[model samples]
Target: MQALIDQIEASLASRLYFLSIFTSLSLPDIAGALSSDNGEASSKKFIAWYEDWVRPRFRENVVSQSPPHIGQYIKELANPFDGESCYRFRCSLLHQGSTQHPKSKFDRIIFIEPGATTNVIHYGQINGALCIDLPGFCSEVLQGARAWLAAHEVHENVQRNLSRFAQRHSGGLAPYIVGVPVIG
Candidate 1:
């Protein structure tokens, strides 16, 4: 998991925004599956995992800012990318190769590339759409995943599931090949 996180970080640092986004979107699924009893990916697990970990990283004020459409009676906005919305986005991007989701609160999601200077656009809603800083989003997800991993590193279930997680072996896996690097 750490290796995968490192790879995502490297991809972001290298300015491979699309690749970083593609891989970053999938981390929640992996973490969610690992935290489950059966180690199978499901919407429930994904949402719960995301809510527990990644959601907290975003600032409360930003996440709570109400949209214009809400009546004055409404006090706060629904998080633009609550677990369900994020899952919708993940499906759209990974399965459909698009950012548009019919069920999503936003018409679409946009990721802003990092600026050359210190100024950066990190997160917000714009005209019924969500805009996130590409690097910042990926980094936050990685941080959340890292924290979850540290907290659960010794858990029997996570350890068991992690055994099945895809990873690269510095040396070839035993009983098949040895002495050469392999990814499986």
Candidate 2:
């Protein structure tokens, strides 16, 4: 029993370590795009920002909403689709039913980065498609993303170290692919 407990602890530690590293690397990439001059003026920039920021948030949500070991279980059960990265893990959770969204037409639009412009992703029931609109609540989401980015900027060096580590262990890292799911 003791050995089993130890093994569980070790495994949890390992997963958390990987998650931390992954989330750390993601923050900068998202932040960079949000802070970039061109990003400031474009709605597409918000998508790039959330591509990284949403994963850990979703993981935490899963852990909180589900059982104690649910996160680990989901991580183990996750099927790595070709070209999908850790960043897309959160989005996958939604699509895979591991994470549930509200039944409303637009579930929740989270602006992971605060103080940035809001860019909304609209989900229409007619086509069951996600339509990203720049004029609505999306503006709030962008603003929130910017705020989150500003709060975490002090960890820039941590991001650099994580990047170096990523380069060294690139094989184990997931690839980030951007694509909308086709709702048929």
Candidate 3:
């Protein structure tokens, strides 16, 4: 898990935000499965893990006011990325190669590229779509996952599942491949 986090962080450091974001979104799936008694991966596990860890790190909502069609102004909080929406986003992005989701609250999700200046735009709504800071979003997920891993390091389920978790072998895995760096 730490190795996975390190790769994501390295991508972010190299300004490879898309790569970082893509992999970061998959962390909940991996960690959630590890935390489960059965050690099985599923959407339910992913959403629950994300809700408990990553969701709290995000802003409550992108827009705090009612839409124009309501005919009257009312305070409303529509969270840009709830567990379901984020899960849908992950599916759409990882499977379809796009951010558009048929069942998403927003038609699309946009990630703002990091700029050289200190001032940054981290999260907001734009044209009914969620705009997130690329680096900030990636970092939040990674940080949350790291904390979760630390807290659950000693759990029996986690320990059991970790044996199957994909990781880099410094000198390759034994009895199959050896003498070079490889991921297994």
What is candidate 2's lDDT per residue for 1-184, written digit by digit as tens? 1222233335434544333322332343445443554332232443455544432343444455687765557663211111123234334333452222343233332222222446433222224333322222222233334556456545654344324332222233334422433211
lDDT of 1 by residue, 134-159 (tens): 87678778878999999997898899
Tell me which residue pairs clash in candidate 3: none
CA RMSD per model (angstroms):
5.6, 19.8, 6.6
Residue 10 in candidate 2 has what lDDT? 52
Of the candidates shown, which would achieve the greatest lDDT relative to the real structure? 1
Q: After superposition, how far is residue 153 of candidate 2 from its true place, in Å?
A: 4.6
- Local distance difference test, candidate 1: 0.83
The 10-residue segment with the lowest total lDDT in model 2 = 77-86
Q: What would the TM-score be for candidate 3 when compared with the true structure? A: 0.85
Candidate 2: list runs displaced more than 4 Å: 1-34, 37-39, 76-147, 150-184
Model 1 / residue 41 / CA error / Å: 0.7
| lDDT against the true structure, each candidate | 0.83, 0.36, 0.82
Give the Å error, residue 6, model 2: 42
Candidate 3 — worst ten consecutive residues by lDDT sum? Answer: 59-68
The TM-score values for the models, in the order shown, are 0.85, 0.28, 0.85
Runs in model 3 lying further than 4 Å from the true structure: 59-79, 116-119
